[model samples]
Target: MFTPSSALTLEQGWQTTGATGSLQKLKKFNNQDFNHLRTSCLSQGVLFEDATFPAHVSSIGPNLLPEDKLRRIQWKRPTELQRNPYLIMDGVSRFDIMQGEIGDCWLLAAVGSLTLQKKFLENVLPKDQGFQDGYAGIFHFRFWQYGDWVDVVIDDRLPFLNGRYLSVQPRTSNEFWPSLLEKAYAKLRGSYQNLHGGYLSDALVDLTGGVQMAFSLKNPPPDLEEILKAADKSQCLMGCSTSGPLRRNIEVRNGIVQGHAYTVTGAVKICYKNGWKHIIRIWNPWGHGEWKGPWCDDSPQWDHVEPKCREALLRNKDDGEFWMSCENFQEQFSWLYICNNTPTFLDFGDQHCTKWSVDSHISLWSPVLATGRNYSPGAVSMNPQYFFKVPDYDPKPYNIVVSLMQKHAEDMHNAKTLKIGFLITMENSKVLEQFSRTRDITKYFTLSPGTYAVVPATTEDQEFEFLLRIFMKNQDYNENSNFPPSPVLPMDVPRQNQDRSYKAVFLRYTKQDSAIDASQLQQLLNDVILQDEMTSLGGRFSFDSCRGILALMDLNSNGRLTLQEFGRLWRSLTKYMDIFCKEDRNHSGFLDVSELKSAIQTAGLAANEQLLCLMALRYGDAARRIGFSDFVCCMLRLETMTNAFQNLAEGGSQVLMTAMEWLTLVMYT
Candidate 1:
């Protein structure tokens, strides 16, 4: 049972599935399965070269050199670069990830922090791989995309410009894991060029499948030290950056560079003979910068500390790792990003350490529905809308984070990202973020206990896919979109005249086997639908639209529909015509949303606000005017999907399916 006043709970985010169960299992990238590729290569005694992400100029991308062809670049295997190369010399460390020519300090910052924890490093960098035994010149690394951990396989080839590597370089000359790991990361993204500039938060999440919480340090929080301490104690990856353009790498002040990204190693309160000092451990991914502020490696303030403390905590080298007072840290850094496997440490109720629950809904905007938004109520309603309740049983409103991440699409190939944002429809607090065209936009909300609707949309009428995730604490949280089931309507068959006309058109175009291909179906519909001027089309049915209709109605999985399928469809089509005629009371030649909703209910179907809004988006034009042909197709789709659900449910009250199973139903149906 659900109530408007009920406290809301959240479910875990949905992720990709394959041979999933253990940490070893992962979704294959570029459709290349690791085990299969490894076995085949080992059996054939051949080196595994991934054609998907080949070591070519295109893979390198044009961003590297102003004139890529003009540069003397060489791609060599690790063996060619070093005499006696070992995959792991002693072990991975922050020192191993020294940035060379690439401008991906954001990624390097995340990678350096990744080396701090053995658990995450093991999950992302599988240990069973090496360059010596069974070395096939093939290696794979895992990164979390959307919600899936994808195994990105790459060849050991690294690019060098006149003897120097172009990307991340390892400290030990003979150790090659760091270099190979960087190459694998480059492969995972489109290219090293794509990784040239990015957000540390994104890299951290990709490395851990964690929730990232970003806090601005300009006006730092009162308990900021406590927050950092909790994150470090929980082994969460932390990072910070100075105020600058995200892509700028030039040093500005106190050895801090504008637009540069750095990793936070730890937060500690070190005690000297006098008192304790709050220190923030910072690491520059560049492997060189030094902060000359108080409490820094060579600061005069270090004279107060004991030799053991100085030896253990202070390092007087250019290793990029330095300590700064929390006060200076807050003043200098622009933002502090913390990425935990799951955002559970920030819970203020220390005695009640309940972890957060998260659920993700993967959706897309199609051309018919992708009417980018404005403040217009109808326009806002047209975008994808999801409703979930939040439960805040305690006196204080509970903590929750909403993340909207756009999946990479064709537009991104040319470096295009759609400006995307989402709105929260709830009473009291209005949680929102200024729209930006980035990979992911996250906002944390402290909402009062109640149900709420989350609406995610893009800025243009261009098709783009996205994932909307809701993370919250507590229980009794679920969605009720399918509530208030469809009511039965009077079942009617095609009118006698409509039936005769459809049969005549079918006979004229269909084969002797009483079947019609997509082209025939298009011709037959065009010929028959216009016989009576009552059936007005916004536009003529295109060849592509005809093909889509055939696919939707194709039950036997054949290319064509039989006479029996056509007959059943004819009845629904004519019935839809009756409802349209009755509801288009003003004879405007197009049914608006209200008319369409009435028509849906008259045809014995669900006409909920959310469903009708989607219907208006799909079938209705920009003005939300549903034409005769559009009405018939839309109603038929609703009915077909409804029947599909009923068939699957049979004796059950509701349908249940795995993500893959649901995908099959939605794709085929």
Candidate 2:
């Protein structure tokens, strides 16, 4: 019994071997290196960021330096650092000290979030330092989820809020301007790191924070006041409308809101260049919602709610806040609406047609045309034509069909006989289908206007070559010859180009009664011709090779070779020639009794010596003469060499002869 190796066991063995060759082969088969796997997973949505947990809060006490110590730390000497520092860079605050400045804030935030879960960071950080520690601050890290380990290099320069700023001078001041630093960091919000630029939303999400949304400033809904009136005590929603030219109206229905809206909860009063006024501050969670407020410098509502509402609303607004006015609200919100009431047609008439074709038959169907007009009896008629074309070498049949249409007013005078004629030619033969009548002849068909019909091709022979043609007759005029000429058009006929023509003929043959072993003879003839051709001496041969072989096989002259004749010819060539060799086995100038016995034994026919001798006597003259050529031919007539040889070994002389004949014929031919 054979035991198969388990893939897991084999892999474990490879891992234990620590062989570079085995690992390389494994990577090749898996189609990935560590870095490739890591990048692929990252591209598909893996995110990593440095997550800083408040040391004191998480029981990991005092992981970062005190404010004074942080201010005194030598930024230039990262290797000398004993504590971490928290700084606001870009728009967000992060704690991870990346060695090199990378523009990927989103990825950094994800890394940070993972750090919050201690296990994640622990799993990815390198375990061994070795010689890899000093050069380029290189460290090995694994993208644990992707099962990839890669080396990363850290640079000295740290990312500052405004730009990548080198810590040329370490500050020793105890009181540092953190606010100013925060402002500077905000200014660097959109800068590029490495090749990628920072996207705050992505970064926030990476940090395990919520994603930000975008909001557009637009006029509040018209039903704002109504919606406010219907507002329940629990529903703290109010609406406001943007003041501008009302380009369009949004319809509110069902429970969906048709237009954009935001929750508003703030107001402010300020003195402007024009005058003192009131302005409403709106917060679009999307982060950029500014209100063209009544509280602005020239607003008439300035004195009424500015100061009081300003503070109240300001307190209400936070990271995710919105604003609206009661006047612009709707009792119900809906995103769909009804526009103008115009007539529309739901049904399309008979403009479409379906067709299916298989083997030699092609079929088409056309339904009644429904053009949204009054219906009339027998308003449309269809006549379809099928065309067939055969490929140059392929023996399969190909076809196409065309449908023609005839209407009453189109041919008023000759309504009873719609005559459409098509010329036939070779090129158009393959176009198995076509439409006789089209709304636009130029666009649809290659027919000229008022031409009755256009010939598809240039040859009359091709037109008449069609195997089948049937005219679609209307029931009322089924038996009438004048009932519109068959809508099926013929292809165009081409002008005579050449006078050459050819014909095909057939022949037949019989089996047992045939004189020559047809199969063997044919093969022999082919071998002779091929050998001569190969030697460049074929031209010297008198007989036409193919003609001769066909004539020999066609024994009855009936234009066909029967199965019996084929089989007999095959068997003859493969069997029957050992007898001739019996007389000349020793080549002693004559056949001695001993030489004959040796020949019979060598041919594996010793047990049938009497039979062998009898056959030798019959084929050979009284002098027992056997020519070399006759001996070779006889040997070349065996049906199958292996079977004949087996029979000869069993003391069958006839079998030996048959086997020799088969082998000789096969080899020589």
Best by lDDT: 1
* Global Cα lDDT for candidate 2: 0.26
Question: Considering summed lDDT, which 10 consecutive residues are worst modelled in model 1?
Answer: 1-10
* Residue 548, candidate 1: C-alpha displacement in angstroms: 44
Q: Please give, for residues 1-669, the per-residue lDDT of candidate 1 as tens digits.
A: 011111111111223433212344466777787767877899999888778777777677775677744267688888887777888888889988788888888788889999998878988888767877877778888888765678878888888887898888888888888888888788777777767766777788889877787788886767788888888888889888776654557786688777778989989888866889889989998788878888888898889988787788888899988999999898888889888765654654455435565555566665455333554455555655555555446622337778888765543455355677777765423355345566677777677666666777777667766766677664322344221111111121121211233334455576333478888877777776646555654555557667767766788878888654675566566677778778988877788888887887887776566667667777678998888877766776677677676676775656567433543344333
Please report the TM-score between candidate 2 and the true structure: 0.17
Once fitted onto the true fold, the runs of candidate 2 whose alpha carbons sit more than 4 angstroms away are 1-156, 159-191, 194-201, 209-302, 314-669
Clashing pairs in 1: 8-389, 8-390, 8-391, 9-477, 11-358, 12-358
RMSD of 1: 18.5
TM-scores for every candidate against the unseen true structure = 0.65, 0.17
lDDT of 2 by residue, 508-555 (tens): 111222233345444443443224222222122123433333344565
